[model samples]
Target: MTSEAKTVQEYIDSLPDDRKLFVQKLRDVIIENLPKGFQEGMGYGMMGYSVPHSIYPKGYHCKPTDPLPFMGLASQKNSINFYHMGIYANKDLHDWFVSEYPKHSSRKLDMGKSCIRFKKFEEIPFDLIGELVTKVSVENWIETYESAFNKK
Candidate 1:
């Protein structure tokens, strides 16, 4: 479920004890591997990593006042979801992740367009997620986002 927590720490604090560690570990993996220019913050009621306005002043096209979101992590009702915009915007990245998922986990990939659902917290592939985080830099994400969504 979406969190009402305003800050990343608040969001983490709000999670049940069973989820706190997994979520924290995932957050740590993302922060450690995240490219230099994306900032960690709360967006869309979840913990978000985004390209701040200073980097891309236009902000998100759908919500101009908000920073451009790159990735997000949420503790859903039945799963902990990881959202990556790179896979949504780049076909090559999506295909690569899809092909590589089986190498990391025995469980079938539970995914939506950009949201990867981890029903079993212990089964979450932190290493794969870390690698995916590094696959797109802030500049690359902005270019990809514009090319995919900002048609002239």
Candidate 2:
């Protein structure tokens, strides 16, 4: 469910009580492990971690005024979804995450191109997510994004 909240805290505050803690913990994991030069804000109605325009002046090609989105966290109707652009743009990173997922959670992985959906909140592997966040730095993400989506 897309939120209409204007800020990260507002987005969090709007979540159902059952989802608040899981989402918060996931947010904490991402924030603690994310490399330098990324900023946290609300974008597309979710909690987004991005490379601010100060670091990448071009911004997102689809929306030049928005920051370059690297990751996002949202509470969906049936799951908490984590979106990582690096995993979607970098095959090596995608392969690494796909291979490692089974080791982290007993539940079978439920994922889309870049969105990892956690249907069972109790089984969410914050540690694995933390490690994944550290795998791509701001510079690496920008390079990967440009190569994969911004080719001219």
Candidate 3:
């Protein structure tokens, strides 16, 4: 779920004590593995990583004023949401995660096309999450995004 948070710090600060540590840990993983050229900020009302407007002037296809989103992390009422655009756009990555995530966590891998949900902090698969984030760099994401949009 989205929040009215104006900054990443604000988003993190707003989380309750129970969820804050987990969110921070997840954020740490994303930032640690996130390649250069991707900036962390507030986007889609959640803490997000994006290709900076300076690097990709065209911005997001649906919202040109906003940077091209790479990933997002948020605390929801029921679960923590870890959103990955790389997984959403790439079939092999999605397939790999779907088939492999269960092995990493005994808990049910609650996921949508891109948003992986964890009901508790222990459910997060840090190694796999880091691997997924590092799979594509900002340059590759830009090229893939451009190619896909150009085709449309």
What tens-digit string does per-residue lDDT give for candidate 3 at 1-152?
67998988888999999999989999999889988889999988899999998999999999999999989998999999999977888898899889988888898888898899899787789888988889899999998888888998
Overall local distance difference test of candidate 3: 0.89
User: What's the TM-score of every candidate structure?
Assistant: 0.98, 0.97, 0.95
Best by lDDT: 1
Computed on alpha carbons, the lDDT of every model, listed in order, comes to: 0.95, 0.93, 0.89
Question: Please, what are the lDDT tens digits per residue for candidate 1 over residues 1-152?
Answer: 77899999999999999999999999999999999999999999999999999999999998999999989999999999999988988889999999999999999999998999999999999999999999999999998888888586
Better of 2 and 3 by TM-score: 2
Q: The CA-based lDDT of model 2 is what?
A: 0.93
Candidate structures ordered by lDDT, highest first: 1, 2, 3
By TM-score, is 1 or 2 better?
1
